[model samples]
Target: MCVQLQAKDLLEQPIWRTAELIKQSKRHVAAPDGYVSSFIDFIELHGGEIVTAASSCRVTSGFTDWRHLGQMGVDFGWGNPVTVLPLSTRRLLGSDEPCFFLPHSSVGEGKGDGGFKVLVLLSEAAMPGFKIEIDKFCSQEFGQL
Candidate 1:
């Protein structure tokens, strides 16, 4: 969304369009274009640990698309989530799936940083860049590796 690339073009993109992309996603190694695991690696390097991770599609009962929750920002509330970015150094999912951290009604009341948690309805395309942004912030603010 930042550079104007459509969602489908980002998420469901065919590997043929970018040959190295397929090569990178293969089992033994990761390509430079890897978005998900890179974020996880960046996070762990910086000491920001993953608190929880799960697939919203499988573990959540959100009952709403959640995007509409963004409207709460008018009253100082975080709206809905649009997607999830998997952050795993392993470059794949096994029994444990991706964790979704999105805008929730109680962001500031939590135990550690005070931000609350909620799962949002989202597409896969939006996650890569999103992961980059959050990981970048963690590195900048907390001196994460």
Candidate 2:
């Protein structure tokens, strides 16, 4: 389930207040622990308009945290995964390309002070420009050396 909040509300509120808002949203969506066909019917009828409107928005956020599910620990004899990657967003529910928050491997490149990875999908044409912009930002923040 996804939650939506206004940018103004998020930015204007203090951390504690923002947390409270999140809690409120969660409580508002609380459902019984069982398959509810009514919920699906309700969303199918209403979600189309919301999804269409949100597609044109400047940004949309989604959470894909499954760390609590111990996704990283699963191994089919190949060994633990170094990273989990998300597929393209060609036919996803949300308008904007969804972002994924993945657990970083405790070893290798992901290790060091606390580190996590965010996977975003972008078009092939956008890659070069995005790479340049990211490189520029990294050079500025990490220094020219």
Candidate 3:
């Protein structure tokens, strides 16, 4: 199921309503004229344009959310992963620097924190400014530095 939503609408609606909208918008994938077929047709029709746009765009970063994938609970003999990081050396979705939204570590100091962690791969040159923004956001949101 694919749901398309405008950013303005998403921001204005409460999370529960947004989730309901997404649920209601789901279409059966088994249909002959499903999203996959439409997507394939679209790609066939605009393949050149897509390639051109991808090549021309300078996408530096990408984001993926893996919060509820139960990665923290998987015991691999050595116990669950203390940290999870993407190992893509090459660009993914044209982004060299990727950010992953991960579940907090389930062991040690992070246990029971009830907060998520974001693993961001950024250039050394960009780190200072990024840290400042992150600190500012944390301070504003949590009333602490």
Candidate 4:
């Protein structure tokens, strides 16, 4: 379907809330297309960001939310799934910031507690400060932030 991305202080959000927001956004994703009969015409007049799921999809700045298909108990007759690895060959189109959301690993050593893993890409100039901010969040217990 479609989804909207609204900026927020992600690092401070609890995992459950994050998941809830994602679930909620999934519902509104297709609304613009269905509600606006001249959606294409509207985009043509106003311009819009291109969204894609291609392995090589690119974005100047955006996020990929894999949580919908993530953590599903998919099996290929290899027994119960022990983990899920989310990846893509896509590179940031021209954006300085991009983020990927993937499911957390299985319990015990691989467990992410109750949260998922997020892969964030930022410019070299921003890494140091970003690292500090992340460190602050990680200082708490697994689900605390």
Model number with the top TM-score: 2
lDDT, model 4, position 64: 71
**Per-residue lDDT over 12-126 for candidate 1, one digit per residue giving the tens place of the 0 to 100 score:** 7775754454344453235454555665686778645443234333432112123344533444345433332334423122112233454444433442332435443334766
TM-score: the better of candidates 3 and 4: 3
Candidate 2 wrongly placed segments (more than 4 Å): 33-38, 42-59, 91-93, 106-114, 121-145
Best model per lDDT: 3
Error of 4 at 142 (Å): 7.8
Q: Rate the local accuracy (lDDT) of all candidates.
A: 0.42, 0.62, 0.67, 0.60
Candidate 4 global CA lDDT score: 0.60
- Model 3's number of clashes is 0
When 1 and 2 are scored with TM-score, the better candidate is 2
Candidate 1 CA-lDDT value: 0.42
- Residue-level lDDT of model 2, residues 1-145, one tens digit each, is 4456687877787889867766765665565642245557768888665443256566565556544457677898998776665555553546455566667766765463445676766667767987997789777857641
Candidate 2: clashing residue pairs, number: 0
In candidate 3, stretches whose alpha carbon ends up further than 4 angstroms from where it belongs are 1-53, 141-145
lDDT string, candidate 3, 1-145, tens digits: 4344555787898999977865664554556787568767978998675222134445445556788887777897997788765676355444557678878766577585878877788878888999898888887856753
| Clashing residue pairs for model 4 | 2-29
Residue-by-residue lDDT tens digits, candidate 4, 2-115: 333434655576778777877776665556655244556766776666534343533345577666684556767875466565354344433336677767767577454666
lDDT of 3 at 50: 28
* Model 2 weakest lDDT span, ten residues long: 30-39
In candidate 2 the C-alpha lDDT for residue 87 amounts to 58
Rank list by TM-score: 2, 3, 4, 1
| Deviation in Å, model 2, residue 117 alpha carbon | 0.6
Question: What ranges in model 4 sit over 4 Å off?
Answer: 1-28, 32-60, 92-96, 110-113, 139-145
Q: Residue 145, candidate 2: how far off, in angstroms?
A: 15
